[model samples]
Target: MKSSKPIAGRYLGYREADRAAPYARFFNPELAPLAPHVCAALDRGGVPDILLPDIDQATTNLFGGEAVLEDGFVLTSDGGMRVSVRSAMPSVTPAMVDWWFGWHGDAASKYKLWHPQAHVHVGWRETPPAGASGRVLYVGQTSIVDEYIGSDLIRGAIRFVPPATLGFTDKSLDDDQQATIICAQIGLGDAPIDIGYLAHHVRAVPGGSEMRSRFWMGGRHVAGRNLIGGMAAVVAKRVLSVTESDARALLVHCAQEMPHLASFLPELFGEFKDAE
Candidate 1:
């Protein structure tokens, strides 16, 4: 196995950012050229109204004080890519987030997919019912080529575990402050490829609340890690370009279909609502 140092340096560049406040910036300079394409795709997906009335109040009600929102994308050390728009959902509790993460109900429809009809299979092992840990299969799509037939869905297991699993234990934290760790093991037909870890941190502020997510990816190939890394980067660009649109579509779908999630919306600018 190759050392993950180089990959980590490329993907986890956010660690060098100003951590004093929520920051939004791209990590991989090589991927900078794709930003316009990503934004354009997102525009076509019809962005939702993320800004809603009482959004700050709602975050305060659920998380603690004022809310913080940030948007950006990262190229994983192993070549995978993810674009995220995160904000504090004050009206939604950590338990709620945990539930949503575990729940597979209508998930296939809720999120944008290259293949809407693709079947999704989920299995749980050594996990609680409310806070889940399990494996999910995209059914027909496995390899990179298969992604064109539908989507390059990772054949992996997703687990929602305690922060301690990631070595995050702070005694001075408040009771209302909470954190959730989600990890994924990516592979194909028993052969591991990559791993992803995401940390969801929620804390109470003086008058409201804040939630932040940190995501990282690591290559898992036992050999030819560099070759796999190159291929992954190429695939990441293609996948991320379309996925950005998918994300925007997802937010819009949630706002329209799941009214309960409205509390997290930022006031929608005309451009987002009227996207072509």
Candidate 2:
């Protein structure tokens, strides 16, 4: 419910020279052209197709079998929202995908590179150990981010977790070359309250990988960051009303940002994989 105006001002504190100094040429405000399938997805928008309670089944569906809905959104029966999006990462590797999640949270400028037009800031609550990197830094960490999901600029606490923790199997998760899943609990920036869950499944194909992302918001996943937050979560649904418009914006934002990030992530990771 907070406006992005003050949030924008808060993180706009970083100097462009200092922030872009490392990534230098990679910081681009203009977005790369979206993949053709992404373009078609934008045009295919319609009514909410999946229920929020169906999120468990939907999550199961994406785990092993063919996906149920690649790019879509729905207003759940429980007054929540469900969103799905698929991005074909032509040359991005699973390792790079994991690395980006760990690295981008350290700074606003680095976060902006993922979606220059939308991302405003990223700051970690507690950074991983001194030598930690890759999935090590991400799986047990939280990143507070401010970004636009359409016209609405929003702030989120993206808390990453292990694939196994989110129900991914050993078989499905065995080989990093085969697949890598990034799972998270989505929370509010100010309050210690989680409102949703998200999984971005990146499966290796011939040349690159594909990211299948699903989000369940404002329903069963809702929880307080602590005991009090947990108690408050009981009425979370009544107070936090998620609308069809919110769902649509979420779909559009994901559709645009994922592929855009995929375009440059591989190169960015290769360059900064060893740096802080």
Instruction: Compose the digit string of candidate 1's lDDT tens values, residues 1-276.
Output: 121112222221223332322211211112112234334434544222232212122223223455532334433343333333344454444434433344332223222121222223333434232211332322222221111112333334343444455555554233433543232323332232344444455554343334444343332221212576556644543443333433343332222222223232222211122221
Minimal lDDT window, size 10, model 2 = 6-15
- Per-residue lDDT for 1-276 in model 2, tens only? 335565435543335564646785676667767666666765766544542225557556685465365777777767777887788888988878877888778878778777777788888988865445433377788889888877776778998988767777747568777788888989988777889889898888888998988888886677887998988778775777787778878877787788888878888878888887
* Per-model C-alpha RMSD: 17.0, 2.7
Span of ten consecutive residues with least summed lDDT in model 1: 23-32
Off by over 4 Å in 1: 1-69, 76-84, 88-90, 102-119, 126-150, 171-194, 204-211, 218-276
- Which regions of candidate 2 deviate over 4 angstroms? 1-4, 8-15, 18-20, 33-36, 39-42, 46-53, 130-136
* Residue pairs with clashing backbones, model 2: 48-74, 192-225, 224-229
Q: Report every candidate's CA lDDT.
A: 0.33, 0.75
User: What lDDT does model 1 reach?
Assistant: 0.33
TM per candidate: 0.38, 0.88
For model 2, the local distance difference test gives: 0.75
User: What lDDT score is found at residue 235 in candidate 2?
Assistant: 71
Best by lDDT: 2
TM-score of 2: 0.88
